[model samples]
Target chain A: MANHTSTQASFENQTTWAGGRSPFNVSYGKLMMWIFLLSDAFTFSTLLVQYGTQRFSNVVTPITTKWPDPASIFNHFPFMHGLHLPLLFVSVMTFILILSSVTMVLAVEAGHRKSKSEVARYMIYTIIGGIAFLSCQAWEWYTFIHEGARLDGNTFGITKQGYDHLHSVGFGDHFEWADGDRTFGPVPFAALFFIVTGFHGFHVFSGVVINVVVYIMTVRGVFERRGHYEMIEKAGLYWHFVDLVWVFVFTFFYLI
Target chain B: MEFYNKPGDYDAINYIPHTESHGTKELWKTFWLLLGITVLDFVIYFVMPASGWRNFIFIFFGLVKAYYIVGAFMHLKHEKINLALVILVPMVFVLGLISGLLYEGSALEVMKSM
Candidate 1:
């Protein structure tokens, strides 16, 4: 009995040593998630700050300056033209993302309960939600590209000039006036729009991939062997982070 | 040492994992809260004036919604208070940075207009 007790104690000590000590007593995965989120927060902050600066500087431009209203800019379908629908597509995208976040939370809940089927069901729903968001983003991008917003010379009519030009150029020069109708060329605004939204879309894409992997593992009962769905909880954290970023985007980019 | 192998040791280390059914209730509550805040956001957008009172209202509601989403949905509320502070402090700094940038940009605009 003594030898057996000693052996168990030794094993426990070795296990503790191998695991290393956490400063906050949190799990390794959770700690890493926090760190990753902190860095991501910085990236988003910089993007928003820069966007605000540019927007504020442009606001002083004269009313004649043709800054593309987001409503007009985003309202339309790619290839299937003349839809003239404002924010309809984006609204659908937002709904999908938000719904997916809900499903992800459910999945995390199922994992906590150790219900394999429930967890798998919710995970699949989350994956579909993610895919829907990506599809909407793709359409948004395509519509943006098709609109012919030029990244080069005064194409679409929005100029990056400061307030000084507001008096001289007015808002009309801000928009492209050609062939008796105002048209936009693909230029700086388009470029910036693509870069920011594209980056966000990529994050969504990555999130979908992560969800799919987790879904497959859950279906295969991998997490069951471990007796928990901690992995799902971790992935849910990431999904929520993406959703939080979109809240800021909706406010700053779309509404503001 | 002896406590480590006690019958309730596992329970001590791990939170009493709420059942999936309980989690569903939590999820629904979160969804409703989010919707409420979104409605409030739209109200602030349209109903409030652009300056002074409106601006204050918008910012206040925005922060409230942000906190709700982050705190409840993101599980920051379940985390240690210190950890929550770590995340929130940086966000506050970001807001300050945004305000500073807006101010500077406006200043430059005024200068050029002059």
Candidate 2:
């Protein structure tokens, strides 16, 4: 007991709150961000799992109009209209996002070196990459609404034809499906597509907003004044997580 | 009061925070590996015949990319084990949810047959 008293006194010099400088010496904010991201990951995982369940269970015997093929649905690139570039534009978008991640890491690295300009430069590049990715998403959504494969009148939303009938018969506005032909399949597939991808798009949009705010802060010398760029590093963690989720979405939705 | 780190020498920066700088070499290494994996995924999708194994390959490559992003880009590889577990443990639940639903789906299919 006498010997333990000396060790207890030694810890008195250490902050009682930290209990020896945090487990793994992790910063409070970063740890909290990680926890938040973990929760977010679970949310996304559930959506995707549910999507998989519905899709595979609905696989039919004839296979004429199964679930929509993503490769065909998302095969357009900007300015190359009507071209059949399967997964190329999406791949470009993926690479852009990955490139932004690399730039973010550079920004964090520069921050470590206390190079304000370097951090700002890399941060600007990262923000631009985010904007590019958002633009791609917009193009994708536009193409989906106007040109991508549709289920038409299928009960399960499985048919990929009938767009020509819509145009030839002056069914311009209501291309989704005619009520008379609704027995082919239901509309769950399109609804699910919008829900899942819309959810992901919303995340990316929010991430871009966060990145813009952080970019403004970086340019304004806030981190430099604080003498640490951990702020940018924290933002980088979030950006990377967004990119990571996209990796899964791209595979499950498009490539696979 | 806000805590801020003092600036370190350019060369010494990586050593000061006990956190390695995301050096260009390390960043590019991961970037190339991830890019290559994605390209391979596309190739396999195009060249290979559709089968049960194809989906598994896609998942395998996807997992590899996820590991890299988490480890290198997110810097979790360098983080303490306690901190890493903060994310890893919950992921078990995610996996459970996925596998459980898949099993349930198969069970339902069997029921339909019977």
Candidate 3:
């Protein structure tokens, strides 16, 4: 009985705060990646919190003080010009991000199985998805800028008549902003839109770059020689984090 | 218990936990779940009239999407509880910040009216 107790005590001691192994059971690199992601999350949350505060402070009055309705401003669909397709384009963008996130995870899983070609293939798919999302964002920014939305000012605030007109138009119907409909509204409206989404877009761009580098490394049999594909797992964590941020962005920016 | 007398003998930087393929089935399921929730969000946006209730629903769905992404896609669910807590617990403060500022924001609106 004394031998059994001693053996169990030593086992417990080995697992707790041991100098040789990580107490968290994660590698050094992966733990750093998670910590970096946590810091990034704080950054994004601060931005979003500022956005919510600014929006709430500008109470929706009859005309000038009202925050612009996102659906009215973001109703454009690519190749379907002059049609008021509210929420459709952004939905497509969301779908692209979600799809790419899946591909990234698939690549990580394939790496676990030591399937070189499969990891490469999935990484390529993920890179394509990131590029596609970036393109969609480019078009969106262009359309917004073209509509007189600037970083310092916004002309998308719908007047009472404008709000009525916007409500009258059905989905996919031809619509244009009449002269009396728009007035200069809250400045932070356009500013926050650009800042938050642009930040996310930059992340997608970097994620694409990282994915390409990883793809090249995989092709060169670097991981095979190292006997582990842990790099893919690290990159996968960043990719999925970007997706997680978008879910909140979609909710607060467009859906709300 | 044996201890490494030299730091070079224990390379912590090169240490990685052994990983295994849990199959693509769970990953694909999570993808579909995320997709379905998004579709539902789109549908509700069109079907329901805008109200506090609608906004609440949207926020709820967003949380659900976030859970699946972090839990399944990021593999946090399979990680040790200690790691998960370390990553997630700080987010509570963010939530608190959001709620506090939103209230303060509404109060600012009242002040502006004055």
Candidate 4:
């Protein structure tokens, strides 16, 4: 009888300990996510700083005629009328990303409840949101490329008058009219923009792929078997990191 | 089957109450505050006249939004204060670097115009 009583007590103690334990005792996946976010933040900050430096150095040029404006550069849509939309696509992308982050949080919450169905639903939403954002980015890139905004060129296909109008407006006001003859050679600015933003977009794409795989396993009840939503929480960290990077991008690329 | 009915069976069972899973009203309150900051940023950017005051307003709103993003979204507020400081100090350095570079670049531009 004493042996049985001791075993019962031990079981109770074990259950209590496990129940009361904090999520912090989980593995290093979430911690590593945070570190990755910090390093990625630094990479974006450096790129933006460089952009700012270049912009400031060129500020003395006549704002009306010489500056390249981001609004004009990114204004095209294939099916829409030739409306000079400013940051519309980017705004949509931003909203999609933010919504994805929200879905990610919901997924995390579902994970906490061990609600596999809820987790799968939210994860699907998150993936959809990510895909939507990527599609918008691709469209934006297509427009940019179609408009002849090459990395090496004297005239990025923007007329001097258009360039002036763009400069008078706002951020992305430092781009210049590529020389008309296409003889002025490649401008390094376009390359830099592509590199930085492309790298970020690549991160987003990879994140979406990872979440999709996780979602599949979620549907198969893998995490349910593990008896915890730690994976959801880790994925939440990644989603939030992507959103955080966009906050900086919006500031440096748009608002500033 | 033996392990399933082990003495510590309940310990292996994870049960998270729905109430604990869905953050309480406190989280909503924080979300509202962040939205308010975002609105303030937009207002400052669009409504304010271009001047030193406008610039100040923009910077202030930006910092506020950044603070909330770091504190609330990143859960820095729940961390040890020293951890917050460690993370924030490097950000401060980056900001300083930005300002210095902009200043030097602008100065050079001015000199070139002369």
Best by DockQ: 3
DockQ per candidate, 2 decimals: 0.29, 0.39, 0.51, 0.27
Give a tens-digit lDDT track for model 2, residues A1-256: 3465455455445663556335545666777788889988988998889877766665544533455555655656787665556678888989999998999988888888878889888988888998889888888877776743243432433343432232233211223344432234435566666777778878878887887888788788887776677888889888999999899888878875
Off by over 4 Å in 3: A1-13, B1-10
TM-score of candidate 4 against the unseen true structure: 0.74
Expressed as tens digits, the lDDT of each residue in A172-246 for candidate 3 is 899998988888888999999999999999999999999999999999998887777889999999999999999
- Give each model a TM-score: 0.78, 0.81, 0.93, 0.74
Q: A9 in model 3: Cα distance from truth in Å?
A: 16
Interface root-mean-square deviation, each candidate: 5.2, 5.5, 4.2, 6.2
Kindly report the docking quality category of candidate 3. Answer: medium
Q: Name the candidate that leads on lDDT.
A: 3
Give the candidate number with the greatest TM-score: 3
* Pairs of residues at least 3 apart in sequence or in different chains that clash in candidate 2: A154-A184, A154-A185, A155-A184, A155-A185, A155-A186, A156-A185, A156-A186
* Better by lDDT, candidate 4 or 2: 2
Per-residue accuracy of model 4 over B20-51 as CA lDDT, tens digit each = 36462444455566556555655554455444
User: By summed lDDT, which 10 consecutive residues of candidate 2 chain A come out lowest?
Assistant: A166-175
Residue A72 accuracy (lDDT) in model 1: 43
Superposing every Cα of model 1 onto the true structure, what RMSD results? Answer: 6.7
List chain B TM-scores, each candidate.
0.64, 0.75, 0.84, 0.65
